[model samples]
Target: LTIVCIVGGGPAGFYTAQHLVKTRPDVQVDIYERLPVPFGLVRFGVAPDHPEVKNVMNTFTQTAQHARCSFHGNVSVGKDVTVQELQEAYHAVVLSYGAEGNRTLGVPGEDLAGVHSAKDFVGWYNGLPTNRDLRPDLRCETAVILGQGNVALDVARILLSPVDILKNTDITQPALDTLAESSVRRVLIVGRRGPLQLACTIKELREMVNLPGTRPEMEASDFECIAKMLKVLPRPRKRLTELLLKVAVETPEETELERRNSAKRAWGFRFFRSPVEILPSDDLTRAAGIRLAVNRLEGEGEDVWAVTTGEVEDVECGLVISSIGYKSLPIDPAVPFDPRKHIIPNTMGRVQKCAGLYCSGWVKRGPTGVIATTMNDSFDTARTLLHDMDEGTLDISTVKPGSAGVTTILEKRGVKPVLFSDWEKIDSEESKRGEGRGKPREKLLDVGEMLKVAWT
Candidate 1:
């Protein structure tokens, strides 16, 4: 029987496996994941509080349990195993490894101790093994968060969420303690433009504004800015406009101020300014303040917001969280990646030049949509693959399951592949350890912990 070796265990990988095995019962499928456990970003990327969104994992697990499917954990391309070997051994190789990196907000003071990327912060709270100890040092009077996306909103809500309310969740050790001692009294959410243009869903914004510690408040000028934009903003095809209208009509100025004040009383923010540069707080420190680029509404009426010019000013903030956005990472040399788009170059699901290679999910398309979108993408790829199989055009070389030759080749090449059992033990240990802490499972962050949990 032909063995289809799938790489990654996220929504795309397992979905594809589910499709491939269901269609062709005679075929054998092996899913290889770099993590000791499965479910890539879903296990670590989505916010922990939204347990409903994470229910996708249940379906993924069910798919993995198919008789024709097997899982091999802790194996990676380039370091743990070579892409060329899988090409030679398996009938087909599918790369569903979603974007593994976050887009950096390349700004000054970004490398400082108190600054954190939203990606790291989200992972720390969501139990990504690589960020179990990741914590935001919130022991500051003021905190500034840049960007206005859903992820940005997530960071904002999490920063303001009650520490006691989060005790039962699978929060990282450092994050838990930091929240318990968080000295952050005021949080400033800065945007380059007004809130109308903020790239966040209304639901996410509400989650932030209505968090337990504080309802978020808006400055009168901030509301004015939003109201003014609403009167003249164009109706675009994007859903953002729909949400904009909903906010403008449903929430007027009187209630807006009340809600804003409520949020302010709870957790306040300063809006409508841009950050020019981050300045140091003292004469002898890395950075203790931010040099804000002041702005003014330039155009009058329709033209009023058309131009904005600013003088420079400095603002003091103890910590900064850059919540820019998420980017789909380009595939490494191990896979055929489109550098310009950061996607795996493929025709349908098939890799363009490489025979017997396929791609699905974010690597194939750009990063987008909910978990359901990923599943549909995988199902499409699987259909294309099945077509090739029926025509006998799929040329798979002879290879045995867990064979001696394969093991020798991996060892000789210094590729330490993580097998299925390793992941089970890692899973067991994490769950068992979590019982004492009254959490779901304690994550293993960083490369060292991952190795110890999976291999040692």
Candidate 2:
């Protein structure tokens, strides 16, 4: 049997397994994940209010239930077992463990109390086990988010959204309680680029614009030249820019004007600004505001860079979240990694200088694109592996014990793998808990609780 082991239970891992099993009937796929629960970012990073995006989990569940596919959760690749060991036990090893590290703003006072990376903040609200204790200080009225990506918009939306809206979602009770009493009414999403160069898609921008109780307070000046540029831009970008123009430049219609006037909260984009420092509060224990260096775009079209103008401005706010991006960390000593790019160095998902070792998703490419992009990228990797096997580049003639061999190693180390069936038990328990709260699922924020439910 051609036994393949994938080290991650996220979208990339499951997508790769789905392709592997469907293409070759003899291939038995095993997925090992660090968390007892499956679906990585879908569970821990996506905003609770966006349930439709979470529907992809159902497809992953179907993949896990395949007779030739097995899921082993609660197993850390580098700690509970090593990559080298998995390579020995399987005909091929695919590392899909996604980007878990955050890219910092590299500014002073970044370690201040009210300063948080968007990853941890998203995790806190989404019931990620590690970030459950992150009780962010929401006593202040204004929150400054440093980035203009979709994640930045998500953070702004969650902070300014009405408590009643979020309470109905699967957001944890503690987070719901904290948000209910939040005094924050203003959110500024700062970026170092112009509207034409925004990283966020139009859908996220539309959601932010239509967010209840909040009005767009964007600078009219930013959209001044954008009108002439729209005709030459791509269709997707043109539509997004037109929307921005309507909100930021053109005079609103009667109904829209009334909505803006009546909004109780406000959100806006601060373009051509880059964070210089996170200013400390009076006691110097937490963030008070952020010092931004004013910038100007140096080039035309998408090939532009922010150039500092030697002028800086400070906006007073209580909380500062850096939503720059995510970085992939080295999972094991044996796997070749590029420290600068924060990704595994690979050619079409084949790890350089290492046979039978491959990677996909964020760890192969950088953390970019949506779930569909990840699916296509993972399929390419699986195809690459299959090509290698057919070309005699990978020797699959010898028997590899796959999960059976890995289980023996894990047993020796006193680490019990949570099987796919066990995860279903945890899922059922969570669903039952959610039924009491009138939500889809009330997530168990504690890993121990998840393990207990699974074992029971």
**Per-residue lDDT tens digits of candidate 2, residues 1-456?**
788999999989999999999898878899999999999998888899999999999999999999999999999999999999999999999999999999998899999999999999999999999999999999998999989999999999999999888877889888989999999999999999888888899999999999988899988888777899889999999999999888888889999999999999999999999999999988998999999999998987789999999999999999999999999999899999999999999999999999999999999999998999999999999999999988989889898878878899999999999999999999998888889888888889999999999998
> How many pairs in model 1 have backbone atoms within 3 A of each other, for residues 3 or more apart or on separate chains, i.e. clashes?
14
The TM-score that candidate 1 achieves is: 0.83
Tell me each candidate's TM-score. Answer: 0.83, 0.99
Error of 2 at 85 (Å): 0.4
lDDT of 1 by residue, 1-456 (tens): 777888788889989999888878777788878766788878777776676787887777777777878777666655566677777767788888887777776667667777777878888777675666655667677777877776776776667777776776766666777777887766777776654556666567667645654744455455554544554656541345445444433455686556655553244444456776666656535456776665565535333342236566666777787776656664347677777777888899898888778899988887766688899999999888888877877875465543344567767876566655676667777778778988777666565566677777
C-alpha-based local distance difference test score of model 1: 0.70
Query: Worst lDDT window (10 residues) for model 1?
Result: 299-308
Q: Which candidate comes out best when scored by TM-score?
A: 2
How large is the C-alpha RMSD of every model relative to the true structure?
4.4, 0.8
